[model samples]
Target: MRLMPDEHQVRSLDHQWQLGNTRGQMRTWGRGQFRWTTFDLSVERGPDGKRRIKKTTLTDTADLKNPLRDAVLAMGWSWRARLSKL
Candidate 1:
């Protein structure tokens, strides 16, 4: 599945800008109704002074049966991979 941000979504992303959440992500799926998932990314320094990416998924929902569940999950992982590159 392709995740393309629409005009409204781009506008909503302005909130992230305002909050200085440069490394966060927000994604949604579904048509008439939607399921949203968000990730917050942060960086912390360890005792060795190394930096690492910390990610947190902000949305929690029941895992109901869906025919496309596997594909959707795969897509989410692919998205995460792309994020890691950034």
Candidate 2:
């Protein structure tokens, strides 16, 4: 795996991702289509003193790119919205 950084971590998320374990296939649901997929993420602490997510879930497994960015962004923004009050 290549070393990289999470803007939130001030640390590298590349370690969270690896070339290995790229074989765990699961399921993917999109636009009424469900298919096999895999998980490729892990949760860890970031420099922000909060849970920093380095994709914290499956990325790409079936040699296809993970296609949940918009949904993830929605949740991310929602999380931030909740945190904004604190």
Candidate topping lDDT: 1
| CA lDDT scores, all candidates in order | 0.40, 0.35
Error of 2 at 8 (Å): 51
Model 1 residue 64 distance off true place after TM-score fit, in angstroms: 8.1
TM-score computed on alpha carbons, candidate 1: 0.30
Report how far off residue 24 is in candidate 2 (Å): 21
For candidate 2, write residues 1-86 as lDDT tens digits: 11123422111111122243458554342232223456566678888888865753454432431333234445442112111112
- Per-residue alpha-carbon lDDT of candidate 1 for residues 1-86, written as tens digits (9 for 90 to 100): 23434411111111111232456554432222234466899999878999988889875332431334455555543222121112
Provide the TM-score for each candidate, comma-separated. Answer: 0.30, 0.22
CA RMSD for every model? 14.4, 18.7
